[model samples]
Target: MRTVAYYKGCLASLSAKELDISTQALAPKVGLELIELEAVTCCGAGDIHEAEPDYYLHLNARILAYAEETGADTLMTVCNVCTLNLRQANHALQGDPALLERVNRNLTKVGVPAYSGGVEVMHFLWLVAAGEGYELLKGAAHRGLKGLKIAPFYGCQILRPSKLLGFEDPDRPSSLERIIEACGGEAIDYPAKIKCCGFPIIQAREETALAELIQPIEQAKEAGADAMVTPCPLCHLSLDAWQSKLKAQTGKDFQLPILHLSQLVGVAAGLADSELKFKRHVVSVAPVTDKLAV
Candidate 1:
């Protein structure tokens, strides 16, 4: 089993507990032994980055320092925002020796280990799509997705600003589709697959967020997607939990189930629905689960 430092981020650790639970359960099945980072703080989720750039760097640098303490060469994240923040911090620190030295000095003052720019930050989806994790997934998916048509939702963070999180082509990504196929499901290709789910701007612009959220599901539903899967819990929350508001706004009921990338893999690996916490979702995953072969 490949051991790496796991960073579940704020959402997975809190509001999106199911993502954390499912990811922890699924990791071992696919030959990954996750050494979760201890006492890690929020990655600022882009808010701090915009308001206080130095503070954002320190926060992410602290998280990376925790990963370094774990003695793992890689730091794994499940959230798109967290992945971006950490990767951006890593890039900035590694590219500038002076900045890394200053950050290390700050960490030292706090009795934390100085970061040596050793850990490579990676998103879980990228791990599965690009390495031996893919082969392990294929081997472990005994039950398989069979007839399910899963649409891949690669929300903005994981794909955009390609210089930092450039695991795949931001313009034309195929990692999610590759993962869906590895689990024996048909990967539905849709234009909105690469579009934003609008969770970030929801608080300030409800109308705009709803408009952005509706397009992708509408396109996915039209394309005959049984369910849509995303690596980001924030996207899952906006796409799944906000459906009621969306129905209220547009008068169209979109019951399309949104599964976290981990849940999708857990199902394909023959994990029980309860184990994956399907009941927690606002949209019934039954529509997708019912199509699976027993």
Candidate 2:
């Protein structure tokens, strides 16, 4: 088994720490070792990409530099946003030597060292499915989710309008649902599977964010999605954040649980309740947990 360094980005290491815990827990069953970074920093996620582009590239690139220092070629991450940002930085560095030089200069200013485009960055899901083959998926899966009407929702960054991490097709993505069914999950047809959850405007425009969120939830509900599964942490916050507010404003009634791909995969892994930290979620997974216990 090769040692795979996990670049548990700033958000996951700090606020969304469960994401780190969840994905690390997942790797062992898949015959992979998720080596933790000795020193990690923010990928300069969303805002940096637009505002401070040069510093952003160097910071994320330093992570790649760290991985290369270990002689490891693959860097895995759980955050879709971080993965995108870092991948964007790496891709830019490889193509434009001028931009790479500038970013390296900025990196030195931050004391993160130089980034030389030495490592490949990946999302943990993509990494697992590739490393383990579908068989480990078969082995880890124990839950009979055969009857579950799941909407395999891919948030904007993960699947995308195209470009970043071309591990799988962007427009007609099936990787998530493919793994879902392999683990005995039943896939549902939801219209808004590719729609953005309006995560970009959340801080600036809260009401718009909620309104944007309603679209996916409504579409999933309309298509009879028993639960919505996503790989993006920001997307989780959007869909699950203002549940009551959405209900009150739209007068739409339903209790839908937004699950991280790790959470859903954990269930398929047949993880014991003791192993899965189901309580860390701001959104309740009780309805699903109740069924699991019975």
Candidate 3:
């Protein structure tokens, strides 16, 4: 069995437990041995870097250290922000001796081993969609999303700063689209395919944030997307959790059900709606579930 350390970031641990639930429940089916990192903490998600750069560096380094302790070759994250935070920290620490020393010093303060960049940080999407190969994912597909139109939401983390992230062509990402197609679904193409979900600036720029959230959703609805699928829990929340609020603000109903990539993959893998906790979503996933029932 191929082993990897699972890093369920802060949002998934609290706000979006369903992503964690579906990922754990679906990993085995996709031929991965997921080892959960219990000692792991928040990655700080780029926010702490602004004020306390050391905190961001140290927090992610500590998480990487824990993953190393698990003896796993890779640290797997389901959240885009977590992937960005951890990967950026890993890239920085490995290349900069001074930064690594500072971060390791902080980690040593808490009795954790200093990070030596031993483990690879990656998104779960890379493992299944790219690493394990689409054929493995397709072979695991007991049920097909034959008629489902899934709009792939990449968010920003995995795509931007393309040199460091290295997941896909930051200019145009087809990984998610390919995965959706491999699952037997139509991947809808839209203008906002690579746009930010505005979760990052909701506090500082609420109005602009709402507008950013509205763009892709409306585009997806216009493109005949049955649901929006994303890998980021924060993006999921920005799209699903804030739908009603956006509807009220814009006087337009965008009741599109936002799905975590795992949930969508689980559905394609023939898992039941109950198994993936569809009801946990604020937006009713009835459209997608009803299609699955057929």
Candidate 4:
């Protein structure tokens, strides 16, 4: 089995435990031995934008530092916020020695050694696609997710700064879309496919954020998508966790099912319903799955 360090990003471990558990479960199923890094902190998602920006950079760099210390070439993450923060930090550390030095100083003060940007950051979806290879998953599928109108939400973080992705396309990503198709799910090309989920300004610019995210969600809904599928947990939190708030803000009745890429893979692989943890989501997948089943 291939070994990889699992970085559960702050939101995944705390705010979104369901996705975290699903990620951990999916690993062994796909022939991966997941070693989780201890004392893992937030990937500087919203916190990076607040109080001290430099500290956020160091904190994020520190996580990458920990992953490198384990000698793991690839670090798997589930949160879009965490993936974005870690990848951006890795790029900064690799390009600028001075910046890496300053962040290292912060890391040393905290007893967490500095990182030199060697470890690669990958979302769990990418790990399944590349680490185990798409062929492995396709061979393991017990039942296809037939007739499911799966909306592929790439958001922005995973597909930017092409150098960071190594081989994956940074802008027009097919990583998640391809996975859906491999498992016999219909990957729909909705208009807001690559739009940002307005996650950056959730607290201060909530109204604007809601408008940004809601537009894409509304588009998916109008497009007749059965559910919104994504690899990022914060996109899950913002789009799924805050759906009620989004509904109140928009003053209309709307609900769209959001499933992490891992959960959808579980569905195609014939993993049990409880293992996928549809109940953990703030937005219910019961209606969506029931409809899909019929």
Candidate 5:
């Protein structure tokens, strides 16, 4: 078993609980022994990165401190924002001695071990698809998602800043598509596959965010997608939860069922709907599950 520290961010711990559940269910099948980091706090997602830059250093370093104590060689999270926050912080502390000293100074006062740049941080999707390899997952596909047409949604943060994350070609990432194909599903190619999910500005620019969110849904529908899958919890929220609201706003009813990549993997791995918490979703996933009989 490949041991690693699992960081469940604010969204995964609360709103997107199913992402956490499905991830835990699918980990063992992928040969990952996830070590939960309890003491780790928020990664200062969203506005905090701009409003309070030092807070990310202080909090993320402390989170890494816990991961270091666990002796796990890797630290992983499912949320794209969390992954970006932690990964950027890890890179920053590793490169700049001044920032590391300042962060360590904060850690010492809290009785937490200072981060020594020991653990490598990765998004769960990258860790599984790139690190574990798509073939390993394909070999484990027992109940597989054959005959299902799926569109892969690559949200912004995890892929961008390619030099930092180093997971895939940001312009043309096929890891998610490959993983879907490995799970025995048909991965559809669409124009908006690489488009933004419009999650970040949802609160500030609601109308603009709605337009951005609906663009992918309509494109996926046009491409004959049975469902859309994403690795980011923020994208999941925008694509799954706000889907109908976007319909109401645009007067075009594109009821595209959105799912987390982990949930899709769980189903292909033979996990039941209850195990994946399908009922927790705002938009009914029946459109997606009904086609599962295919």
Candidate 6:
């Protein structure tokens, strides 16, 4: 089995617990043995990076250090922001020797190992869309999605600032669509698939956030997507949880079911809905499940 250090960011550990559950459950089925970084703290969700850049590097470097301790060359994350933060840190530390030494000195004081910038930061979606993981996904899909129409949502953090997270073409990403097709689902093409879900600015601008959140769902609905799937828990929160608020503000009900990437893969792999934690979602996934049944 391919071994990697799994890092579930703050949102996945808390509000998006189902994302964590489904990811862990789906890993072994795809020939992956996840060594979860249990002691790792949050990647600061970009807030720390913007306000306190040095502390943000330390936090993410600490996470990388923990991953190094696991003896895994790869550190896999389910959240886009976490992936970005960790990658940004990795890039910074690897390129600047003096900065690495300084961070190492601070880490040493806390009894944590100094990170050598050896671990490669990767997103789970990238794992499944290419290489052996893609083959494993194809093999595990016993009961494929047959006729389900899934819109691929590549949230901002996972794709943008391509110099750092350059796994796929940020402008025209096809990883989600590739996975959907692999599982026998119809991949719907829509403009809002690559747009921001507005989670980052939700607290600062509720109205703007809701507007950003609704656009993709509305576009997906217009494009005939039965459901939407995303790799980022923050994006999932904006698309799924804040949907009600969007309805409240607009007086329009766009009941688009949002699935975590892992959950969608689990469904295609014939995993029981309960195992995927379908009940935990704010929006009912009944529409998607019902269609899958038919």
RMSD of each: 1.0, 2.1, 1.3, 2.5, 1.4, 1.0
Number of clashing residue pairs in every model? 0, 0, 0, 1, 0, 0
User: What is the Å distance of residue 45 in model 6 from its true position?
Assistant: 0.8
Task: Indicate the residue-level lDDT of 100 in model 6.
Answer: 98
Residue 201 alpha-carbon offset, candidate 5, angstroms:
0.9
lDDT (Cα, tens digit) per residue for candidate 3, span 170-194: 8788999988988889999998978
Candidate 2 lDDT over 1-294, as tens digits, reads 657787877656665666667777767877668778878678877788679876676667787777766767778778778788878877888789998787778767877667677788878778655555456767787775656777888888877635777877887888778877877777777767878888778779878887878888888888887788888877877777666678888898657887777778777787666456667676677777776662
> Which stretches of candidate 4 lie above 4 Å from their native place?
49-51, 98-110, 113-116, 161-167, 291-294
Tens digit of lDDT per residue, candidate 1, span 121-230?
Answer: 99999888877988899888878898699999999999989988888889999999988998989999889898999999999998999999998999999999999999
Give lDDT: candidate 3, residue 229.
Answer: 96
Better of 1 and 5 by lDDT: 1
Candidate 1, poorest ten consecutive residues by summed lDDT: 285-294
TM-score against truth, every candidate: 0.98, 0.91, 0.96, 0.89, 0.96, 0.98
Candidate 4 pairs with clashing backbones: 159-170
- Across 56-141, the per-residue lDDT of candidate 4 in tens digits comes to 77777878888888878888787766777788778888889989888888888879977877888877777667645577788766
Clashing residue pairs for model 5: none
lDDT of 6 by residue, 156-242 (tens): 999989999999899999999999999999999999899999999999998888878888999999999999999999999889988
Question: Where does candidate 5 stray beyond 4 Å?
Answer: 131-133
Candidate 5 has what TM-score? Answer: 0.96
**Model 3 segments more than 4 A misplaced:** none
